[model samples]
Target: MSLIKTEELVHDYIRRDEEGNEDGRIRAVDGVSLNVNRGEFIAILGSNGSGKSTLAKHLNAILFPTEGSVWVDGKNTMDPDEIWDIRETAGMVFQNPDNQIIAQVVEEDVGFGPENMGIPTKEIWERVEESLKAVGMWEYRKASPGRLSGGQKQRVSIAGVIAMHPKCIILDEPTAMLDPSGRREVIRAARALNDVEKVTIILITHYMDEVIYADRVFVMDKGRVALKGTPVEVFKHVEELKALHLDVPQVTLLAYELRKRGLDIPDGILHMEELIEVLEKICR
Candidate 1:
């Protein structure tokens, strides 16, 4: 079943003059339609200003569509009465962890969500424990958010969302600010949540390497989905992705190059190991 769905979604940003006079409207998200199935790990890829982040906001009802509809867990985002319910059903983790982390201590931050939901104290603590452990941050439950590393803080932010027990998590460039190691750490935590916790993941990132493991990938250009397929299927169009000002996984690019040079390498070779195996086969 689709945990989230958007139908002809259109969002426009209205520009105003200095005196607050209406100038014009710029369409950020234009005619976007997609479905995210329950328990699926979906990646959205695009360069800056391609409307990927705009689309992510609609899923969480952070921005209502100007023309179409968005439904989260069968709850319509357009309904004012269902707004909070939709948000609770789909938690959003933004690029900066600092903005998301409220409490000083880690456990308190994680518990904040459940606490706001009016959950009992005992249940809130239970959720905090479960959430922190899920993100591999349980060991630092007593640590201050200020003291944690970039990656650790991001994990805590994720745990905070998990405490709400949302069926799906939308991460909008969650690792954009992290170093390579920190990026790996946060992505690992996201994968764990999807694999072990069976929570749906919608990850929006421009990093080619990150989406290689996704069940499916959607590439956006000019506020529309230009490409949609499994990772292998999408990466197979290396030239097409480049035309969209996007990059494929490094191995996929190398394979594409080799194929161009009259090698027998196949399209969409995602990993170095896969390339090595194919090269060895050709050598034999």
Candidate 2:
């Protein structure tokens, strides 16, 4: 069964007058339909203004669909009574970490989520410790979020969401501002959350390298689902991705260039190691 499901979802931002009349409307998310299964790591990919983030907001019920329905853990998002319950089931991590962390200390920051849920003090502490440990930030639990790196702070923000025991996590360009190493840390932490803690992950990122490990990838455009498939399957369509104004990973693009020069390389060479191995085989 799917943890998150959307059927013909549509979201529009309407310009309103002071008299409460609709003037203009822009369809940011248009007729998007997708499903996310429990424990599955999914990637939502698109260039900016593609409605990827808009679509992501639907998963956590942050933005209600103007048309169609979204179901989180079997509860409809359009239903008012199910809003909080739906959000709790699918936690969200945005692009900026600094805006999310409020507590002076890391452990306290992580504990805030469960604390808000009214978990007992004892259980909240337990959850904080467990969540911090899972993200490899247990040693820094007492440190202030301001002192941490962008990656570390992002991990703390993730720990906060995980502390709530959410069934699914939606990360919208979480590593965009980080350095390469920071991006690695965030991706590693996200993968650990899926592999170790068995949490469903919906990662929205443009780094094609990141999508290689995802169980599935959905590409968005003009507020609609433009492409969808496993990483290999999706990346296989290099021309289509290019048409969408997206690029493959550096390694993948290099391999594609080599292939265009009539080399015996494969389509969608995602990582450096893969490219090296393929070159070695061709030379042999």
Candidate 3:
């Protein structure tokens, strides 16, 4: 069964004057429908202000749809009473690690989510340890968050969400503010959680390289889904992606350019190994 589903979802932004009179309206998320199955790794790709984040907000009931419906774990998001349950089922990680970490110590920070839910103190500590270990941050559990590097801090922030035992995780540009190495660490951790923990992952990323591991990819443009498919299927449209102001993976781009220059290499060469194989085939 699908863990999250959206039907004809629409969200609008009203341009108003000082007195709140509506000047005009912009539909930030237009009539879009999507379904995420349990234990799937999904990537949403878009330019800035493309309504990808707006669509994500609907997953956890952070924002209500102006029209249509959203269901999280079989519960309607519009139901006010189910809000907490939905939030508990779907945890969100934002771009900044500093904003997400509140507790001084890493272990304490990880336990806060379950602690606030009125979980027993003993169980909360157990959950904290397990969650920290899951993210490979157990060694830093006793360290202050301020003393940790960006990658470590972000993992701790993720560990806090994991302690809640959420069925799904929505990460909105989680690595945008990090350096390349830090980005690698967070992405690796995210993939590990999705692979081994059976948690649903919705990764919102602009970096084409970062999404090669996702099971499916959705491309958003101007508040609409422009393309949807597996990584190879979607990245094959080199010209179309370029027209949308998006770039393909580095190796994909190189292969596309090489193919255009009369090389027999195929389209959608996503990895370096694939490009090398194609070149070897030509030499043979």
Candidate 4:
């Protein structure tokens, strides 16, 4: 059964001018239907303002569909009784780590969620240890969050979510504010959560490189899923993605260009090693 499902979902809201005048209804998410299975790592890619983030908000019940329906973990988000249940089932990590990290200490911040849920003090500490260790931040557990690097801070934020023990986590552009190393750290932590803890991960990002690790990829455009497939399958449409102003990974782009120049290369060369293996075979 699908862990999360949306049926013909539509989210619309009125725009307002600075003078507080209504500027009519704007459709941010238009008739989107999606199914996310348990423990699957799904990536949603889009340029800014494509409504990918808006769509994600629906998954966690932050925004109700203007027209359709959203079901998370077999419960309808529209049901008032299921709101907290849905939120607890699917944790959310936003773009800014600074905004999410509440406590001064790393371990304290990680335990905050579970504590709010009324978990016992001992259980909360145990959860804090495991969550921080899961994100490779155990060594810095007692350190002040303000003293950490961007990557470290982001990892702590993820640990905070993991401490909640949610079945699924939705990250909306979690790497956008970090350096390359920070981005890698956050992505690695996300992958570890999916692979080791059997957690369902929904990674909403614009970085093409990040999508390569996802089990499935969804490319959004103008409030709709313009493309959906595995990373290789989605990246195969290089020209189309470019037209949509999206990018492919560097190696994929190079492979595509080489194919165009008649080098007998295939499309969607995701990793450097894959391209190297193919080139070796051709050269031999």
Candidate 5:
């Protein structure tokens, strides 16, 4: 069953003059229709101003559609009565970990969501522990969040969301500001949530490498979905991505180059390991 669905979704932002006079409307998302299945790991990719983030806000009802509808776990986002339930059904993690982490202590911050939801104290603690452990942050639960590395802090932010026990998690460029190591850590934790916890994941990122593990990818362009497929299927359009002002994974680019040079390599080589396997077969 589809955990999230959008029907002809359209979102428009009103452009205003400096004097605060009404100007015109700019369509941020235009007639997007898609369904995300339960337990599916979906990635949305796009360059800036392409509407990826605008589309993500609709997933959790952060932004209501201007011309269509969004449903989260069968709850309509337009319904005011179901707003809280819809939010709880689909949690969101934004790019800045520092902005998300509230409590000074890691454990306290992780428990904040459940605590706000009025979960029983005992269960909240259990969730706090498990969520931290899920992100490999249990050992430093008592430490100050300020002292944690960028990656560790991001995991704590994720743990905080996981503690809410949402059915689906939408991460919008959650690793955008992190260093390479931090990006890997946040991505690893995101994958674990899908694999071990069986949670539905909708990840929005510009980094092609980050989407390699996604079950499916949707590439957005000018407020519409320009491409949709598995990572291998989507990465085959290396030049297309470059044209969109986006980058393909390094290994995929290399494979594309080799294919251009008359080598019979596959189009979407995701990683060095996959490329090595293909080369080994060719050498045999």
Candidate 6:
């Protein structure tokens, strides 16, 4: 069964005037319909103002749809009784780690979610340990979050969400504020959670490199889906992506260029290794 599904979802933000009067409406998400299967790794790509983040908020019920419907783990997000249940079933991690981490200590921050859920003290500790270990942050369990690097702090943030035991995770540009190394660290942790723990992951990112490992990719523009396919299938259309003000992975771009130059390379070369292997075959 699909872990999350949206049907013709539309969300509009009310623009206000200086006098706090309703000026107009800005459609953030426009008639978007999609399905995310259980244990799948899905990536959403969009330039600024494309509504990917707005669409994610709908999955967790942070914002209700102005039209259409959203079902998270088979529960409607619009239902008042299911709001908390929907949030617990689909946890969210945002772009900034600092905004999410609240407690002084790492373990305390990780345990906060479960504690608020009224879990037993002993079980909370168990969840804390498991969550930290899952993100490779267990060694820093007792350390102050202030003392950690950006990557470590983000991992702790992820651990906090994991403690909630959500069936799916919506990461809204989780790596946007991080350095290259920090980005890699958080992405690796997210992949590990999806691969090892069978957690369905919906990653919203601008980095083309980050989506290479995703099972499917969705690209948005003007608050609507512009393209949807596997990474290879989507990246093959260099012109389409460029027109949308998006770029493919570096290797994919290079391959596309080579193909344009009349080389015998295939479309959608995802990695440097793949490009090299193809060139080697052409040379032989």
* Residue 210 accuracy (lDDT) in model 4: 93
Error of 2 at 131 (Å): 0.5
Each prediction's total of clashing residue pairs, residues at least 3 apart in sequence or on different chains, is 0, 0, 0, 0, 0, 0
What TM-score does candidate 1 get on C-alpha atoms?
A: 0.97
lDDT score, candidate 2: 0.91
**What CA RMSD would you report for each candidate?**
1.1, 1.0, 1.2, 1.5, 1.4, 1.1
Deviation of model 6 at 87, angstroms: 0.4
Model 5 lDDT per residue over 131-200, tens place: 9999999999999999998899989998999999999999999999999999999999999999999999
RMSD of 5: 1.4
- The Cα RMSD of model 3 versus the native structure comes to 1.2
lDDT of each: 0.93, 0.91, 0.94, 0.93, 0.94, 0.94
Model 3 CA lDDT for position 239: 89
- lDDT string for model 1 (1-284, tens) is 98999999999999999999889999989999999999999999988999999999999889999998998989899999999998899998989878988898999999999999999999999999999999999999999999988888999999999999999999999999999999999999999999999999999998999998899999999899999999999998887888898998878888988999999988778999999999999999
For model 5, the superposed segments whose C-alpha errors exceed 4 Å read: 16-21
Preferred candidate (lDDT higher): 1 or 2: 1
Compose the digit string of candidate 4's lDDT tens values, residues 1-284: 58999999999888898999988888889999999999999999988888999999999999998899999999999999999989999999999888989898999999999999999999999999999999999999999999998889989988998999999999999999999999999999999999999999999987889999999999999899999999999999998999888999999999999999999998778999999999999999
User: For this target, which candidate reaches the highest lDDT against the unseen true structure?
Assistant: 6
lDDT of 1 at 251: 84
Model 3, global lDDT = 0.94
Q: For candidate 6, lDDT tens digit of each residue in 1-284?
A: 79899999999999999999999999999999999999999999988999999999999999999999999988999999999999999999998888999998999999999999999999999999999999999999999999998888899999999999999999999998899999999999999999999999999998999999999999999999999999999998889998898999999988888898999988788998999999999999
Clashing residue pairs, backbone N/CA/C < 3 A, model 3: none
- TM-scores of the models, in the order given: 0.97, 0.98, 0.97, 0.97, 0.97, 0.98
What tens digits encode model 3's per-residue C-alpha lDDT throughout 142-225? Answer: 899999988888999899999999999999999988999889999999999999999999999989999899999999999999
Pairs that collide, model 1: none
In model 6, the Cα lDDT at residue 149 comes to: 84
In model 2, residue pairs whose N, Cα or C atoms come closer than 3 Å (at least 3 residues apart or on different chains), thus clashing, are: none
